[model samples]
Target: MFYKYETHLHTSEVSLCGHSTGAEMVRAYKRAGYTGIFVTDHFFNGNCTISRKLDWEKQVELLVRGYEKAKAEGKRLGMDVFFGWEYTHNPYGADYLTYNLDKEFLLAYPQLCRLSFKEYSKLVRKNGGLLVHAHPYRTAFYIHYPPNPKVHLVDGVEVNNAGAGSSCNNNHMAWKLARKNPRLIRISGSDIHSTEGAGLAGVAFRYRIKSSRHFVDALRAGDAYLIIDGKITDQEGNPVKEVV
Candidate 1:
């Protein structure tokens, strides 16, 4: 069994995202023959509102609505939709993609509150969600802000990011880390912020992932493939090498 999925797509409604609508994402993913996608928009404590002020509850509400709308559209188009959020950790910042969580959980703990990486990892684990570090090697303003350790505290790392303008050396870094810590999972995604970049990056898992929970479990169990396009394969799965 096999499944093709893109987990880090963005829509225009997101503050920093370009003009890509959820309908456009559905069309693109269907055209690319992808089985599923997770729309993980930016969720920052500082810029949670339209006015760029901290309204954490409103931000979660917006994201929940976005997910519902996208899921409805994807269902109509014969594609699976996964609800997710890209949380921006503050003070020694990092980005984490979390799924299968409720609005209450997000509203309750919108910010990490000076917790160390290890502590934060424990919190995520206790909540039955997965943490994936987003785009660790890009050199833009916010790209290089997150620090990378020889040992990561979370479940996985996103090796490929489509919105990244340069060659992704992050995949190599993630691969080396996964090699060292065999428990770590390496996943790749487009991180698409615009229509043009949607479906441009992804990961193919060898198992038949029927839902969001299955997809997350595949990554947590290290039974997935990372697609960096003409780079290399460090896991098992047939590659669909065309850029979507």
Candidate 2:
């Protein structure tokens, strides 16, 4: 069987929008046949319930609680748990899923919330991290317009968001962008906020990913496929209709 891994998820310990705790989320994924997951709880400016009144360092400390808890549980279950954040770019509701950076990087760079898309791209690249624009084309009633930053600057675009299937998500546009730019990685995820969202989307790696760093490298090298609604397809190449 392929090694499945969830690329995006949140937890009640950190994200205000999340309904389940980190441990609950991990257990749900484990039951769904996933070998690992990235605990991408909301960042400082995202749908975070944490108090921003606290100092930047303190804020990071609070933000990492969910990831740490999830990681610990993943260890106990023999799952590969990794840390990441879903940064909410203010003004526009565009979200970016980041990987390969640890809790310390976030604590060190609290100003991350203030950076423009261009600036954030540079910072992530400098730190050897990958930034995948989550549901880049997703439009919401609250968000006046769809936020599409310079696609070339981002490492990838989430072309399939299972959680967004319930809404009027425009993932087709992201798929077109990926086809036009062969170098741009086309990723997918559940964008899960609750236990029910688990396993709706994930990646199916040809080999078991050893760590978070390896996961990043695999996507960069186009070494995996996307799993959407229980159907699998090679996202590194031409696009196909995701099973609804």
Candidate 3:
């Protein structure tokens, strides 16, 4: 039961991203041998404390269009695609891969600052959604510090984000912090923004996962491995070289 997936990615619809289209991303993932990927574009509120201005509706439209493009390409290439978005928690924290989110849900809840992490997590759970902490170690452009242990919330932590070079170190630190919390699952992603970056980071599941729901369930159930440089391993350092 092995699954190859790149969980975090962006398209041109995201004003900050370099890639122009989701079809391009899917082509890259197909060439890289990825079984699936999550298309997470930037979901920023205009009144956010961070001051980044983005049209919520346009972003949602782009995401939906991207999902369609990626799905069509994936079908031709024999891969799976997941619709997702990167929601900023402002100033120094954010979450990625809010799976199974609808446009109305995003539009209705434009102000993330108004919701507590607990409240937000509940909303996501109530909608059958999943969360992934994106690039916990990168502190340059968007300063994202890891969540405090006392405020234990989130479905999983992304230990490997290829776009952020320091993600490995961040992953290690997150692993240490999350060790005592069995409810918190460990996962990895590419956080890809370009064609070259698409297959750069991912998690190899212990069981084959072919859909977004199955992939999310695997993370929540703690049954996956991180894939880096072709080597697959569990959070505890168990070697899984079959994928390589």
lDDT of 1 by residue, 6-119 (tens): 888777665355366777787788887677888787765323334435476766677666567677889899888887777766643467777666667777876654566677
Where model 1 places Cα greater than 4 Å from the true spot, the runs are 46-56, 110-119, 143-147, 165-167, 230-244
- What range of 10 consecutive residues in model 1 has the weakest lDDT sum? 45-54
Candidate 2 C-alpha error for residue 163, in Å? 1.6
The TM-score leader among the candidates is 2
Error of 2 at 164 (Å): 2.7
Which residue pairs show backbone clashes in model 1?
none
lDDT of each: 0.66, 0.82, 0.67
Error of 1 at 54 (Å): 7.3
Cα miss at 77, model 1 (Å)?
A: 0.5
Candidate 2 structure lDDT: 0.82
Query: Runs in model 3 with CA error above 4 Å?
Result: 46-59, 107-116, 144-151, 166-168
Measure candidate 3: CA RMSD: 3.7
Q: Name model 2 segments beyond 4 Å from true.
A: 166-169, 236-244
Give the better candidate number (2 or 3) by lDDT: 2
- For model 2, the run of ten residues with the poorest summed lDDT: 235-244
